[model samples]
Target: MKPAVTPAPPAKDARRPPYAGYAMAAIGAALFASKGIIIKLAYAEGIDAETTLALRMILSLPFYLVIGIHALVHTRARGEALPDGRLVLRTIGVGLIGYWTSSYLDFKGLEYISAHFERLILFTYPLFVVLFGAAFFRQPVRSKALLAFAVSYAGLALLFVQNMAASGSATGTGALYVLSAAVTFALYQLLAKPLIMRIGPQLFTCVAMGAAGVAVIFHFLATHPFEAIFVSPTLWGICLALAFGATVLPSFFLSAALKQISAQANATIGMLSPVVTILLAMAVLGDTVSGSEWLGAALVILGIGWFTLSERKG
Candidate 1:
């Protein structure tokens, strides 16, 4: 009798480039950059940070709910066990740190700072990620990574000095808030990858976002009246855009990208964010950019682009 043969494993698509993961990270960063612009627009209508955040999470919740439910059902049909309660709780905690606390601080900071300044400050999170990862996770810091870090942060320092000189004392308070947000966000970047690898990216995003949405909603309810959420149709439209475009899409994209790349690489790729935010703020909010800001931005782009190319080659 002839022996039965097993079919060969399917080949990976050679047409798809290795850099696709980097492209996903870039797209995620660009979409996330729009978030500050949209939130600033909502604030222009006299909405408070809590209310704007509430509206964003409210609009965002349904999508996460649907996706979360679908992912559970799909996992069950595939005969897989659900994530344990401990991992689930840990993910929820990370979500709260990353999304709820960080976002709240960020929204509050925006009240006192320009979107350009806010984004640039937030861009420092990658430095925290690299530092924390080396300290806690024992990840080695390569010399090339140090060079990239130095170049990027030197540019940020230039922009920071320029912005700080132009703004009021309130800038100090805002910078503190956003800097705290950056730290928590950096922690989130460190914690998320292993969890994402265990569960799929879609499921991980849904669970994390679901927990964050609930936390934001509860915080809003505890502090503010429902009437606070009522705003002009235009404001609602802006919140809708912020929710779907900035929050939902980018969350999923970043999660998926994490599955393909290291967190440090993801954070470095996100340096594109502040530049995008600067341009959008200029165009939409009539915010002016200085020659120094332009030079600093050029430095940022050069650093990130060079780092990305080197990573690809490596």
Candidate 2:
């Protein structure tokens, strides 16, 4: 009688390559960079930040609702315990800070600053992420990370100086608003990791987004007239594009990437965002780019590419 053959089990290292995480982060950052352009377009249509954000959340809510329900059902089918109330609440809180508060600040900042400058300011969130992670999470600060930051922010400083020279003190308020958004977003990235690990990225993203959507809707109703929701079809189309292209897809991509990479790495990789936003601003908005801006952008890209290669090797 022939002996029964045993099949080989999968290899321990069969998981995705680290580059896959980098790729996901890069794509997410690029997509997210489109947001500034879209918001600026909406602003040109005479849509205020409050109404724009409200419409974005309203349009995005249904997708999160459907996805959240599916994630719960899948968890049950897998015989997994559902997230406890505490976890759910914590996720929602982080979501509100990240999406609701951060987004509001960003939209308001866009009103005062150019899209390129707004993106550049917002791109500084990684510094906060690294600092907060080290302080609160006890994450080790690698020397390479500092070097990458120095290089990247050197470029950012150049752009900041040039923009300040050009725009003067008028950019101060918007800069502050975007900086606040960066801080909150940094907190979100730091806080979300453990929750994502426990509840899974798909469920966590859905819950967080759903909660933020609700919060934004409530805030809108409280501050704006009910009739403000009725906007021109062009604005609605812009909101739709913002919801799916920039918000929904990139949110999922980022959440999934977080499952694979550390928040520091993910945030650092987001340096690509400013470059994308700069190009889009020039192309779509017909904004002018200075020589210093080009040089600053080159440095940003160089630093990011260096960091990405280092991460891949690690």
Q: Deviation in angstroms for 85 in model 2?
A: 1.3
TM-score of structure candidate 1:
0.83
lDDT of 1 by residue, 201-270 (tens): 6678788888998899889989998777778899989999999999889977887898887877787778
- Model 2 Cα lDDT, one tens digit per residue, 1-314: 99998988888777756888888999999999999999999999998899999999999888888888999999999999998899999999999999899999999998888898888766667667877989998987778777877887788778777878888876777778888998899999999889999998779989999889889989999998899999999999999999998988998889789988887788777767887998999999999999998898777666656765675576
Candidate 2 error regions (>4 Å):
1-29, 251-272
Please list the residue runs of candidate 1 whose C-alpha ends up more than 4 Å from where it truly belongs after superposition: 1-29, 251-271, 304-314
Evaluated against the true structure, the overall lDDT of model 1 is: 0.84
Query: Which candidate's lDDT is highest?
Result: 2
Error of 1 at 110 (Å): 1.3
In candidate 1, residue 255 scores what lDDT?
76
Per-model tally of clashing residue pairs: 0, 0
Q: State model 2's lDDT.
A: 0.86
